[model samples]
Target: LKMGEFSNGLFGCFNNCTLCLITYIAPFGIYFVAKTREKIREQKGIDGGFGSDCLVHLFCPLCALVQDAQEIQPAAQAESMARE
Candidate 1:
């Protein structure tokens, strides 16, 4: 992935319906989205602030969550495999 670029589109949530459904149904889903966004920014060394993250989640929360999930899913899977 390149700097400031996501591997998936904003509305690509359907690509991973499980994640999308979880994010949509879970009460603590906002927290998960926030953390995921932080992880993505940190891993990619992208420039942004928590305030912006909050605003994004506060507004287009689902799309942001889906984007974050798509961005990190592969990395998380790879790390899980590495540990095993």
Candidate 2:
């Protein structure tokens, strides 16, 4: 996950909490959360999968960052290719 800056206050405390939560808690919990939600959604015959809220709030940013990193990678690769 990409790290962001933090400052002091309630917001900062919450941010710190979320950072820790995502780093420690989310990895273990997310899989089960997604799986259970998926099963429920499937049983309910919903078209969309689980974690839409979380996806919008968390995964979307990560996805965009990944895309940005991927875009930069090709240019870096090209530069390395040229150097060789």
lDDT string for model 1 (27-80, tens) is 365565666688789898988876677668878988987888888889899999
**What lDDT does candidate 2 reach at residue 44?**
52
TM-scores of the models, in the order given: 0.51, 0.33
lDDT values for all models: 0.79, 0.56
lDDT of 1: 0.79
At residue 21, what lDDT does model 2 achieve? 71
Model 2 off-target regions past 4 Å? 1-8, 11-59
**Model 2 residue 32 lDDT score:** 56
| TM match of model 2 to true structure | 0.33
Compare the candidates by lDDT and give the number of the best one. Answer: 1
Q: Kindly list the per-residue Cα lDDT of model 2 for residues 1-84, writing each as its tens digit.
A: 989754576545465776767755446545554555455447556566456623532456556345445645787899999999
